[model samples]
Every structure is written in structure tokens, then in C-alpha cells.
Target: MKKKTIIEIFIFLLLLVFGLHSDAQEDHSKMNMGQASNKDEPRVTVDVPQDQQSKIGLKTTKAKKEKTLHTIRTVGTVTADQTKEAHVHTKINGWIEEIYADYVGKAVKKGQPLFDLYSPDLVSTQEEYISAKEQKSAGSDIAKVALERLKLWGVSQKETDRLVKTRKAKRSLSFDSPVDGFIVNKTAIRGMYINPEMELYHIADLSRIWIVVTLYESDIATISVGDDAELRLPYDLNKTFKGKISYIYPEIETETRTAKARIEIENKDQKLKPGMFVNVEVKKDLGEAVVIPDDSVIDTGTRRIVFVKTSQSRFEPREIKVGPRVGNSFIVLSGLKDQEEVVSSAHFLIDAESKLQAALRKGESQPAGHQGHGK
Candidate 1:
């Protein structure tokens, strides 16, 4: 009887130990499932009372599809239009006999006499042409060749006509201005010897001017040829000038990482002088896109989040992909729908509360025994 009683007690003890082992396994499995469920759950929305929202100064703006207008403001320097510039040089070696356009900045018209030049070569060519005319008809081959040589030697048409009419070689010939412009540079002096290689005058037409502006690499895509720009002089804020982008430089500056763009503006009044600094504003329309106020975004380094108003008092934290910022708004590439209201002000506090609530919920889902396991 004692042996059978001892066997029964051992069997009972074994059953009890197995039952405890199964219970422990069940608890561990339940804990793992609860943690997994918490991990897979979506982010929860937070609710704020109306009075609390007023105290926090919460403001909301609706995300909507609209044209993104970006204004790029920069500084530019005025420059002369290179296409309308002229460098006056003589084709023959000559002595300056007289100077009519005497000073720099003097405006001269086309065909206007700039100076009188005396050259032995010119005089000899003229004499030969006169002799050829005397020996043969004016249209004869020899006479034509002599006349052509004189013309190639830089003798003006008017001077040639005079030589034909008078049949006399003049000692001094007048050199005319080739274009209507102000002489920005002058190297000619009375009695100074000049040659074909010498530049006598540098004239520039200021009727049209160029404003060169520097654009950062980020802003290069916002500008294009024919885009309108507004320019304002630093000295004259009340006066505004309008222009259009005429060219964009192909290469970017390595040091500054910027490129240059040229804006053409009419300067018929000659008010915009070269080298003057002006403010430039270029407005670019980036077509239509979904956008939200810039203040509504919460950038947490790894990702961007925005609080979307789902109901009267509920704000849902949503992750979104955003593009470039346009003015006070941001272009939303995804994650939010059009016409959805987003919190634009006082969202930081809401974000803090939402994080706190999430932490509490995660703690509640954890097993009670494991709650203080790390500590």
C-alpha cells in the first residue's frame, strides 16, 4: 500500500509540472502575438478640444490643386548689348589730321565724319585712279581696277564720288562713323599715326541693354528664354523696368555653383547705365499641382509628416512626399488628397501629444510581466 501511494504522488507531481510548463508556453505565445499586433497597427489620430485648440492657436489650411508660382529674386548688373557695339578702325596707315568726334561718350550718327586722315598711300592710290581716268574711259578695265583698289583701301563712297566729279586727288580724306552710338572709348588724338590694326573708337548703342543675373543651380530650371522679369534700380525704387530672359549660360561657375542668365530690356532713354546694380524678380508658373502651406510640414530628418484634419477635433499624422517649395506653400507629390484640411499652425504640440499617446498605447499592449523587464 505504501509503494502504490508513493507512485500516485510522483505521477501527480509530474502532471502538475507539465501543466505549469504548458501554461508558461501559452503566456509567452500570447505576449509575442500582442507585440506583433502593436507593431502592425497604424498610427492613431489625436483629438483636441475646441477650447484647447484655440489656446494653442491652431490654424488649418486646405490642401488643394493649384498653380505653383515661384518668385526668384536676385541681383543683376546692367551691361551693354554686345550685338550693337562697334569698333571703328582704319583700313590704311594714316595720320589723324582733325578729330570731330573728339571726346568719349560723344554720340555720332552713321556716315557722320569722325575725323580727317592723311595718308601717303591713300594719296598715291587716288593719283593713280585720276591718271587711269585720264588715260582711259572711267568704265575701262584698267580704270575700273584702279577704282576698285581705291575702294578696297577704305575710301568711302562719298569720297569716291567727289574724286570722280572733280577728277582731283584730295590730300586729306574724311573717315565717317559706321553706326549711330556713343563712343565709349577713344584712342585717336590730333596728328596721331594710325594703322589697320589700331582701333580708334569703341562705340556702343544703348538703345537696348542687358541685365546679367546670377542663378543658383537649384533655380536654373525655373528660368527659360522669353520669360518675363521685373527689374528695379536700387537708387530708384519707384521706377520699375520690364525685361525678358534672352539667354542662359551653358556652364555653371564651379566656385559659386551658379549660372548666368541675360535679360534684355529697352533702354531707349539711356537711363540704365552699364555696371549699375538692380534687383531682379522672375516669376515662374510651375503648372498645376497639389500643394499645402509650408508651415504644415513636420520634417523629422528621416521623413516628413503633416497633420491632416480628419474631423472637427481629430488631426491625423500622415507621412507625405513633397517637392520644391513655392512661395509660402509646398508642392505635395503624394500622401494627401485634394481639399483635405491640414493643420498649418501650432502642430508641434499636437505632434508631441500624438507621440505620447502612441507610446502609452504601445506600453498597454505589452505583457505586464515584461513591462519592467529591461529595468
Candidate 2:
């Protein structure tokens, strides 16, 4: 009977111990479940007292709907307008007789003589035209053909009329400037033999000039032909010249990975010179949009977070989408509204305090038994 009582007591003790252990394990599991659930909860607002805010130098700015003007500033080089440039060439081979334009950089007007040329072929054609003119009934067709041939050889109609009136072929003919411009390049010499294939002079009209600015791939989308631009000399900022984007190179340069934008501005005073570097500013207005200060937003790798002041003391963290930056502000694409105040200064301190408070809350929600175990 004693042995049976002892064995029964031992079995009862074993059962009691196992039941307590199971209950403890169940409680621990419930604590773990509670912790996971708290972790899944949304972030809570941070409350910063006015005194604390003052201590932290906290500041806020209101998100507002306003026009965002983007200014693109870049350096540009002045170039002669290619379309306004003229190449002086001759059709028939000749020997340069009397140099008239004489030097490079000399400004010449239309019909101004550049040089005198003596070409055997030209003299022979002029004689034929003069003979045909003198033949009277030799027929007008022959003279007309000869005149057309002279025109084809680059002889102006005025020169041809002079020949007809003079009734003689001149030893040398004067080549006149076809356009008003400064001779940028001159290959003509006093006795240099010239051919039809040779370029005699390169004339550039400086009445208008082109300012070429480089546009990166990111900026190309915002720029277009006819966009207004302002240019200023590096040495003289007080003088400003206005222009419009006249052309954009279709292909980007392989080495620079940039496209060239051409701005045409009048240079009637010849103040701008080719190859001179100038400052270029292009302004684009991005219509009304919800905007906030640039410093208010924090990029946390995966998300862009901004703290919005929901109340005087309460700031709620919000994830927002943003577009291009305009000046010192950002264009808010979503997750924000106009007139809402957002925290601008001391963001790091606020963000850290918010996270600390969350961790403390998580700890407080833990079961007592688990807390004890952790302790």
C-alpha cells in the first residue's frame, strides 16, 4: 500500500509539471504572435512638443499650387550662321590678275570687286558673243546662246551688257562679291593660278550670329525650336542679347553624349564674335503643380518620405512621388496636397525619434512572461 501511494504521487507530480510547462509554452507563443502583429501595424504619428521643436530647430513649409519655373543655365559658343555664309568660287580656270578684296577679314558689299581674272576660255567666249552681236543677221539665236554660256561661266548680266555696248572683249574680267560679308578666308593672290574646283574666298555675313549650346539627354525633352533664350557675355553681364532656339541637331555627339541647340540672335552692331563663349539661360514654365521645398523630402533608397504636419505638434510620415526639381523646390506628383505643411528642418532627428518611439511601443506590447525571459 505504501509503494502504491508513492508511485501515484510521483505520477501526479509529473502530470502537474507537464501541464505547467505546456501553459508556459502557449503563453510564449502568444507573445511572439502579438509582437509580429504589432510589427505589421502602420507607422504612428510623432508628437513633438513646441519646446522640443524649438530646441531641435524644426521648421515647416506649406505645400502649395504654383507655377514652377525651371531655368537651364549653360555655356554657349558663338558661331557664324552657316546659312548666311557664302563661298566665293569661279567657274572657269583663270589667273588672278589684280587683287581687289586683298585681305582676309575685309568687309565687302554686294557688287564690290574681289579680284580680276584672265581666263583664255572666258576671253574666247566673250569674243564669240561680241562677234555674234556684230553679225546683225548672223541670227539672235547664236548671240543668245553665247550670252547664256557667259552667264553659265558666272558673268553677271551687267557685265554682259557692258560687253555688248563696248563691242569688244576685255583682256580681264572683274569678279564681284555676290553678298555683303567679311572675307573670312582668302586664297586669292596677285598671280596665283585658280581653277573652277578651287574655293577663292569664304565670306561670312555677321548681321546675325548663332549661339550653340549643348543640351544633355535629360534636357533635350524640355527644349524645342523657338524657345526663348537670353545670352550674356562672360566679361559683360550687363549687356543681354535675346534670341530664340532656331535649330537642334538631330543626332547627339558620341563623345559628349549631348545635342547642340542653335540660337539665332541679331549682331547688327557686330558685338558678338565667332568662337566667343557666352552664358546662356533658358527658362521654361512648368504650369501649376503641387510643390514642396526640396529639403523636406528624404530619399530612403526604396521610398521617398516626407513628414507632414498633421497638427501643431503631430507630424505624419508620408511616401510621395516627385517629378523634376524646379529651383529649390520639387514638383509633387502624388501623396501630397496643396496647403499642407511639411517638416523641412531637422528631419533626421525627427525620423530617429519616431523610430525609437516605435521600438519602445513594440517592447511595451510584449507579454510579461516574454519580457521576463528577455530580461
Candidate 3:
């Protein structure tokens, strides 16, 4: 019985040893797994691989050092300059017995005879003048006054001189234009009877021209007298005429929501006339401003941005507020720094790349079925 008891104790001790050994094996296996996990840890880095980098082309521009605001654009019309505008009308209306100017739009000089008329009243005045001249040496002051009256009624100096020498009446009344202008209206025909005071013709002088310009109410504050303006005819856009603001209408036109500005331009050759439609551009000066090359900007609906290259193949887009232009460049009101490297020429490519990236990200956010792949 003593020997069996010892043997049972021995068996119990062996079983306990086996259990402890199994536990130790499990501990060693767990330690080895932890070590393997540590060995598999990835390295930390901030750079993207060359294949994953943005492949868009790029160009750069240095910001211009000037401070400018914005540009104003308006369209206007051309009008005859008031100074050169003329209205020619005849005071004495008579038959156009002999027409010197017979057509509309004919050019005439100042004091040029337009027509000749045979009038009984004119003939009677001339007869009185001839009798006055014959009696001038007979010591009558009334006769001398009648001769002066005939000279005042458009009888030419040469005609009066010939009448004084020949003592005979010259029997025709002459109508003369008082200004150098184009014949705008002609109401009289040859052999037509006329009244004492009637407008037989109309004339317009085309020495200088005007442009009727309209400026929006928002832009009216920027315009003032003597500001430079430009004109372009529709048929000849390449031809530009330069002028200055002469008048600014105090009242605003309600229907158009604009104010009228008058621009005076010289038209010595009569190329511009009344009722000419033209495109007018008011040239505003942006004295000095800080500007950027126009191409450097990328406009998102919500923000205007510019891409700044921080490192090779790396760019960051920044929001910016913009101002007016100083020629080919835009004034930077904010969100830009001088001397920074900006993608000027190929901004469109970079923008397109950004859009693709955004689209990809959006696709990843959607459900699998919504990604356009079959479920």
C-alpha cells in the first residue's frame, strides 16, 4: 500500500509538470507573434511617389509691383459735335432760277451763292438804286440812302460798282449760304415761287464730332469731364477715334439705368456725321498697382485661387481677392505674395487635375453600387 501511494504521487507530479510545459509553450508563441508584428511596422514618410504625383504642365510668372483697382467698360454712340453743328436756312424765299447747289449732301463754302432768283421786288429795289445813283450828284441825301439800301439787300459790291458806273439796275436777287456745311435739306426747285421769309435749305457743318455715351449708374461715379474716351465704328472696328468727355448729364435715364456722357471728337474730313452708331470705350487710367499675370489665376465658383509651387512637383492652391487690370496683368488685392512661384501658363491643366482628384474622392465616399460598378 506504501509503494502504490508513492507511485500515485509520482503520477500526479508528472501531470502537473506536463500542464506547466504546455502553458510555457503558449506564452513563447504569443511573444514571437508580438515581435513579428513590431518587425512588420511601416516607415514614416510625407512624400508621394513619382507615379502618384500630379502630371500637369506648369509655367511661372513674377507678380508686378503696382496697385490698381478695376476696369470699366461701356458702349456709346457718335454724334455731331455741337460746335461744328450748323443749321442753314434762307430768310428770303424766291424762285431758284439758277441753282448753284442742286443736290443734297453737296459741300458749300461760306457766303457762296446757292441760287439766283428773278423777283419784281428785287428789280424795283435795283431800279430805285439806279435812280438814286443817278441823282446822287444832284445833292439829295434821300437818293444816297436808297443806293445804300440796295447794297444792303444782297447786291454784290461788284454789282453796285457796275451800277454806279453804268447808272442801270441789275435785276436779279441772289441767295447765299452763310456757313460752310453740307446741304442737308433742299425745299426749293428751279422756277419755284417763294415767300419773303422761308427756309429753302438746311446745312450741317462736319468739322468736329460727338459721341453719345451711356455709363451705368454704378460706373457714373468713375467718369468725369475731360476723361479720355475711344470710338469704334461697327463697319470699321479696327479704326479707333480718341476723344474726351465734354458733358455729363445730371439726370439718370430710368429705363436704361444709365447716365449720358458726351464725348467730343474732331471730324475735319466729315467722316463722322449725325445719327452715326458707334461703339465707345472709355479709357480709364489705373495709375499704379500691384498686379499678376492674368493667366496665373484659377477661378472656382466659390473662390478665385492661384497655385503656388512649394516644392518640386508639389503645389498648393490658395484663395485670393482680385482687383482691376493695368494692361495684360491683374491687380492682386489680396491672397498673393510677391516673388512666389506661381503656375501661370498651364493653370488650366492643374485645375483640371484638381477637379479629377475631387471627383475621385467623391466617388470613394459613395456606396459601392453608386460608384458606377455593378453590384
Candidate 4:
């Protein structure tokens, strides 16, 4: 009887333990089920694969390490180099009795007779010289010295030598030009009276020229002496003139608010004429400025956005800070790196595609039995 009782107790204890284990397992399974339900379907949807995002009609350029630059261009006029310009004037009071110059556009050489003028003061002086030579006295030689004085006053050898051979006082004497240049200005007409200190003509030496370039107030800082410049004139389409920055105006233009920069250029061929219209571009170093192609940027009022190609098909829009313009590029001050890739062309199309894809992914994140399914 005892042995049978002991066997029954052992069996009873085994049954109770198994029953508790089963209950514990059931409770654990229910907890696991609750935990699985907590993780719902993704909150949004993504239709396009991540690999094909950036290929939506997008063109790109690698961010390069380059110097930054900023410059301004303006319309300018060609001017005569002031250092080479001269005005021809008459020192002796006279009339334009006979103008050997003939016309306004005549070329004259140094010591060449330009016009003849009749003056009582001149004729009397010549007569005095003749009388001095005939008397043959020391005092008379002093008077003859007057004849040589005419030569000192720009009388050519041909004319002065003739005066000695002819021994006759010419009614009018010739006045010569002091320099070789074109007659840029002619104030005295054929018969006009020319007074002492009268400006008869203006001769401009055309071998050198100047270009007056205007720049916006902002660009005045980059231009400096010795910087190189280029000009394209309307008359010469195939030609380009090189020049150097020579001077800058102290003040800006009142109406246009621009600073005028003077560039000196050599025109030994006389191709650059005064008042000629030209386009000028200046080149300078901005000193390691960050930059990108001019076409790579899109400016919205709130932000300046650039499309960065993160991977083969993933383009991300990033807000960037730009400094200034340098020819066909912009100086990227920040928000980009040297080796990253950015969309340089066709960025607008890619922008639209990325936004649309983002919206679609957001919609598909909802579960099949949850909200937004009907739409």
C-alpha cells in the first residue's frame, strides 16, 4: 500500500508542473503577439527605387576645387591718350592770309609750313635785318641778327634761304607745325583772322589710346592697377585689343552710380578711334574663392537651392551660399565641398521629379487596412 501511495504522489506532482509550464507559455505568446502588432506598416510609400531617383532628365557636374572670382563689366568709350595730345596755337598776331594746309584733314610734319600770315611787325623786322647787312658796321650786324631770328621762330630753311637769295621782303611769312600729326581740329577758316594766343588746330598723336570703362559700385573693389583687360569694338569684330588698368575715378557717376576705370592700350596702327563704342572685360585674382558654373544655381526668394547628385539615382536639394560672379561661374562660399557632385544643367526637371517621388512615398507608407487607402 505504501509503495502504491508514493507512486501516486510522484505522478500527481509531475502533472501539476506540466500544467504550470503550459499556462506560462500561453501568457508569453500573448505578450509576443501584442509586441508584433505595435509595429504597423511604414507610415509612407516610395514608388520609385532609390537607385533611379537622380536620372530624371538631370545633368550634373562634379564639385571642383577652383579659385573664386568676382567682376563687373560696363560700356565704355575710347579716348585719346592725354599725354600724347597737343594743341597747335599761334603766338604772333596775324591773319590767315593763305592757308597752305588747304583742308581740315591734312597731315603735317615737324617744321612744315602750315599757313601764311601778313604782319606789319614781321615785315618791319625783316627790313631792319636787310639794312643792317648793307651798312657793314658792328651795329648793323646786330640788325642783321633779326633775319636769323625768323629761322628761330620756325622759319624753314627753304624759306629762310630764299629770303637771303631774293633780298626781297615777302608780304606774308609761313608758320610751321612743331610736331608730326594729323590736324585733329581746325578752328581758323581760310580767311579767318588769327590773334595772338589763338588756338589754330589740335594735333593728336594716335599711336596710343585709352578706354574708359564703367563698373558698378560693387565691382570697384576688385579692379587694381596693372590688371589685364580686353576690349571688343563695334568696328572691328574679329579683333580684340589688350589693355591694362591705369587709373580709377575718385568718385562714382552721379546718374549711373558707376566708377569709371581707365585702361591704356597701344594703337600704333591707329585702329582705335576716339568715341568708339566698346565692350570691356577685366581679369583678376579673387584669391582661392569657392566657385561653380554660372548655370548651376537656382534662386528662390527664400533660398538658393542646388541639386546635389548623392548617388546614381539620388539627387538631393541643398541650400547654398554664393559669393559673387566670375565670368561664366559663381563663387561658392559655402554649403558644398570640393569632390561632391551637383546638377549643373537640367536641374529644374530633377527638382520636380524628386518632390513628386517624395510625395508618393509618403502616401504609400500607410497600411492596406489603415488611412489613405481609399485615395
Candidate 5:
């Protein structure tokens, strides 16, 4: 009889433990449902007091659909245009006898003597031509061939004509500049041996120069060849150089994900020097888009919020995606519609007021026992 009594007490304790656990689980489920319901409910709207509106200078403006010119600003470096550059090289193995345009930055006109080269092969070829000229009965074909050989070695027509008329092979052959430009480079020494593989001088015309601008991938699509651009020097803000896009590099820089654009500007005064930094502005007309004042949008770094005027007094915070900024306005990409009015001024005060109101309302609506449930 004592054993049966003990068993009955043991079964009663087990039932009591399970019943307490069931009650705790039921309460927990109700708390979760309440928290989820609160999350889905829309935030309460805040009404800006009419008396305080004028004190804070609250202002509103309607979003309008209009064409906006978006300007892309970047920095670029000045460079010499490759089309106006010339590389002087020797065609034969020889020694440099003399250099007329010997200094860098020296100006040279077209057909101006640049250097003189002494080559044994050139002297031997000249002798062959002169010998063929003296013996005309030996067939003019030999002389014609030798003259062509001289021309191939960069012997000018004037030099060859003089050689044939004088009947003498000059010790050295003189070379002249092919174009009018400044000598940008000079590497040939008076007695240094030169070969076809060596470059003697580099000449470039500075009347026209190129500006290479680096642009991010996102900005590349807005620019194209023939587009007009404006350049300004940082220290000298009074003057502006205008130019057009001559080319866009097809390859992108792997590390920076940026591309290069070439702009040709006339440098009549020779003020723009190579390697100098200049600011560039590329303006493009984007078709009509929904736009609002720049002050209307509040950027929280993570998300962009704008206080939209729902009614005369009611203001609601809305999230929006914004495109490029033009002048003092921003192009709205989404979450805002045309003809809608937004709080352009004093919106930050309204944002603060709205958050406070929401916090207060949430505390009152939540159940008493669920203090830390939602959090």
C-alpha cells in the first residue's frame, strides 16, 4: 500500500512538470506573433505643426520631369599628340659626324638640317653611281639602280643631284627634318656609332596637344568621340581651354576599372605643357527625368531618405534611388513620382520628429510582458 501511494505521487509530479513547459511554449508563440504583427504595420505619419513651419522655414517643391545636363568632372594630364610626333632613326650602320639641331627644345623648320652621318656603305654606293655616270656606254641601268639605292638610304634628291654634278662622293651624308617642329629629344653624340636600330631624335609639333582623361567605368558610356569638353588649370582659373574628344581607348585599366579619353586642344601660346594637370568637365544632356532639389534627399550613408509631403501638414519619409546630380538638383531614379511635392527645406527637423513619434507609438502598442521580445 505504501509503494502504490509513492507511485501515484511520482506520476503527479511528472504531469505537473509537463504542464508548466506547455504553458511557457504557448506564451512564447503568442509573443512572436505580436512582434511580427508590429513589424508589418506601417509607421505612423508625423504632421508638422503649422505654427512651427514658418519658424523652421519649412519649404516644399514639386518634382518635375525635365531634361538635365549632367557634368562629369575629372582631372587629366597633358600629352603630346602622336600624330604630330616624329621619331628620327638611321637606316644604315654609321658614325654620327655632326648634329645641327643638337639641343633639346630647339625649334626646327621643315627641310632644316638635323645631323650628318658617315657610312662606308654610303660612300661605296656613291662611288658606284658616279662611276656608272662617268661610263654612260656601260648602260644607264647601272646608274639608275645606284641612284635608287642612294634614295633608299635617306639621301635627299638635292644631295644626290649635287653628288652626280660634282662627280664626288661626300665624306658624310646630311639628313634634314621631315616636318616643322621642336626637337623634343636628342641622343646622338658627335662620334658615337649609330645603327638602324638606334633612334637619334624625337620631334613633335606643339601647336596641337592632347589631354588624356581617366574616367571610371560608370562614366565611360556618357562620353563619346567628338563630344565637346572644357579644361581649366587649377591655379589659373581665369582661362579655359576648349577641345573635342578625339578618341576613347578600347581597353580599361584592370586595377582602377577606368578608361582613357583623348582630347585635342590647340596650344597656340604653348601654355599647356606636357605632364601638367588640368581639370576636365564633360557635359551630357540626359533626356527628361524626375528631379528634385538636392536638399530634399537625406543620405544616411547606407540608405537615402526623402521627406515627401503627403498632405498639407503630413510628411512621410520615403526611400529613393538617385542618379547623377545636375546643378542644384538630383535625378530621381525610383520611389518618387512626378508632380509629387517633397520637403526641400527643414526636412531634417521633420525626420527627427518622425522618428521620435514612431518610438513612442511602438512602446504603447507592444504587450506589457513582451519587454525584450521584439528586440
Candidate 6:
């Protein structure tokens, strides 16, 4: 009976210990569940006193729908306008006797004498015209044919009349410039034999010029003819010339993987010279978009953050998706709305406080997957 009593007491003691262990485990599991539930609910609010705000120059601006211009900047080169370019070629084979516009870079005006050429064929045609006139058969078909031949050869009617009045064919005929421009190229020389195949002079009017810029395949779609652009010379930054996109080449350059865009600008002052490098800005109107001051947003490489004012002295950090930036603002694509206010100046000070508060909250929160053990 004594051994039975001892065994029964021992079994009761074991049951008591096991019951306490299970109760401790249940309590520990409940505590862990409570902590885990709170881990994901980290706090993210910051309060700045009035004095602190004033000290940091913290300022806010209300976001609103505003018309903005998206600019694409690129480098380009100035070139002569091809349509205004003139290539001087001889209509008949001749020998250059005199060169008035003798050298490259010389400015020439319309109807200005460029050079004098002597061609036997031209002299012969003039003599025939004079003979037709002397016969008083100038109105006859033969005389008309002679006059037409001289005209077809680029002989002016004045020169033909001079031949008729003098009854003598001049050895050389003077040729005048057809346009007012600078002589970009000149191949005609005194006493040099010339033919129609030779281009004697290349004149280009510099009053209007073209700036050809290269655009990547991605940027080409946003550009079109008649889009406004601004051009600035590398040497001159203060002055900007207004221009328009006049043409876009259909073919893409294979080596550079870019397409060419032509911008026409008036340079009546002749300040812009061909072959000079220039900076081009093509502004595209994005219409109405949600915009905030440029200084309002903080760009962390991984994401963009902006401190948004929730109430007086209270701010919240918001991650936003942003589009192209305009002059002094950014196009907010998401995470913001019109009429909302955001910190615009000295927001770095507010940002630091907000991030610190968030970090502390995260540290205070218990780990989600942690399991507590019972003593």
C-alpha cells in the first residue's frame, strides 16, 4: 500500500508539470500571433513644428493641371539651305576671259557680273542674228530662229541688241549672278576652258539656314514638320534663334541608328554661319498634365519620392511615377493628383525626418515569422 501511494503521487506530479508546460506554450503562441499581426502595419507620419519648418525653409505648392512643354535637347550642325543654293554652270562651252567674282567667300548680288566667257559658237550665233536684222528680215522665220537660238544659249536680249546696233560680235560675253549670295565654291579661272559639265560657282544665300540634327529612332515619332525649335550656338549661349522643323528624312542612318531632321531658321543678321555646331531644343506640348514644382520631388535611383502635405505641419512621403520634366515642373503620372500640395523648397529636411520616423517604426515592429518559445 505504501509503494502504490508513492507511484500515484509521482504520476500526479508529472500530470501537473505537463499541464503547466501546455498552458505556457499556448500563452507564448498568442503573444507571437499578436506581434506578427502588427509587423506589417508600420507607421509613416512626421510632424514638424512651426519654428523648425521656418528654419529649414520648408515650402509647399499646390499641384495643379498645367500646360507644360516637354523639351528634347540635342546637338546639330548649321548648313546652307539647299533650296536657296545656286550652282552656276556654263550653258555653252567657252573659255573664261575675266573673273569678277573670282574667289570663294566673295559676296555676290543678283545681276552682278561673275565672269566673262568667249565661245566661238556664241559669237557665230550673235553674228547670224545681226545679219538677220540688217536684212530687215528680223520678223522672218529665219531671223526669228537665229534670235531664238541665241536666247536658248542664255544670251540676254540686251546683249543681242547691242550686237545689232554695233553690227560687231564681241569676243567675250559677261555672265551675271542669278542670285544674291556668298560664293561658296568657284572653279572658273581667267583663261580656263569650261564646258557645261563644269560647275563654275556655287552660291548660297545665308539669310536663311538649316540646322540638321540627328534623332534616335525613339525620338523621331514625337517630332514632325512645323514643330517649333530653339537653336543656340556653342559659342553664344545668351541668344536663341527660333526655328521650325522643315523636313524629316525618311531613311534612317544605319551606322548611327539615327534619322535626320531639318530645322529652318532665318538668319538675316548673318550671325549664324554654316558648319558651326549648335544646340537644338525641340519642345513638345504635352497638353494638360498634373504638374508639381521640380524641386518638390526627391529622386532615389530606385524610385522617386515626394513629401506630400497631409495637414498643417504634417507630411507623408509618397512614391510617384513621373513623366518628362518641363521648365520648372515635373509631369506627375501617378501617386499624385491635382490640388494636392507638396513640399517644394528645402524638402530634404522634411524628408529626413519622415524617413527616420519610418525606420524607427519598422525597428519597433516585431518580426512577422518569429516564433516565441515557452520557458
Which regions of candidate 2 fall more than 4 Å away from where they truly are? 1-50, 254-257, 300-303, 351-375
> Cα RMSDs of all predictions?
14.2, 14.0, 21.4, 20.4, 13.4, 15.1
Q: Which stretches of candidate 6 lie over 4 Å from their true place?
A: 1-64, 291-375
Give the per-residue lDDT of model 6 (tens digit) for 292-335: 98888887665677878887766766778887778778889999
lDDT of 1 by residue, 1-375 (tens): 578546545543433333311122223232211232332323346666655676567789999998888888999999889998889898889899999999998989888889999999888878887887787665466667767877787677889889888989889988888888899999999999999899999988888999999999988976789999999999888899999999999999999999999999999999998889999999998899999988899887656788888777777778899877798888999998899999998786666555544545567779988998978
Estimate, for each residue in 1-375, the C-alpha lDDT of model 3 and write its tens digit.
Answer: 578546545543433333311122222222211221232211111112234333323456766666554455667766555564455444444556888888989999877878877767667766776665566577356556666765666555556666667867655756677778888788767888877466677776777777787778877766689988778888998998888899898999889898888888888777787887888777666666567887788665545677676665455556678865545677777877777777786565444444333333445559877776774
Q: Please name the candidate that would achieve the greatest lDDT relative to the true structure.
A: 1
Q: Candidate 2 on 1-375: residue-level lDDT in tens? A: 578546545543443333311122223232221232332322345666665676567899999999888778888999999988889899988899999999998999988888888999878888888788777876567888888888888876677889878878888888888888899899889998998889999999999999999977778887788889999999999999999999998998898888899999999999998999999999988789999989999776656778888777777777799987788988899999999999999775565444444445668779989989945
lDDT: the better of candidates 1 and 4 = 1
- Model 1: lowest-lDDT 10 consecutive positions: 19-28
TM-score of every prediction relative to native: 0.76, 0.78, 0.56, 0.61, 0.76, 0.63
Query: Which residue runs does candidate 5 get wrong by more than 4 Å?
Result: 1-44, 52-58, 137-139, 254-257, 300-303, 346-375
Each model's total of backbone clashes: 0, 0, 9, 9, 0, 0
Better of 1 and 3 by TM-score: 1
| lDDT for predicted candidate 2 compared with the true structure | 0.79
Candidate 1 deviation (Cα RMSD): 14.2
Error of 2 at 139 (Å): 4.3
TM-score of 6: 0.63
Q: Write the per-residue lDDT of candidate 4 for residues 235-261, one digit (tens) a residue.
A: 675789898999998997888888888
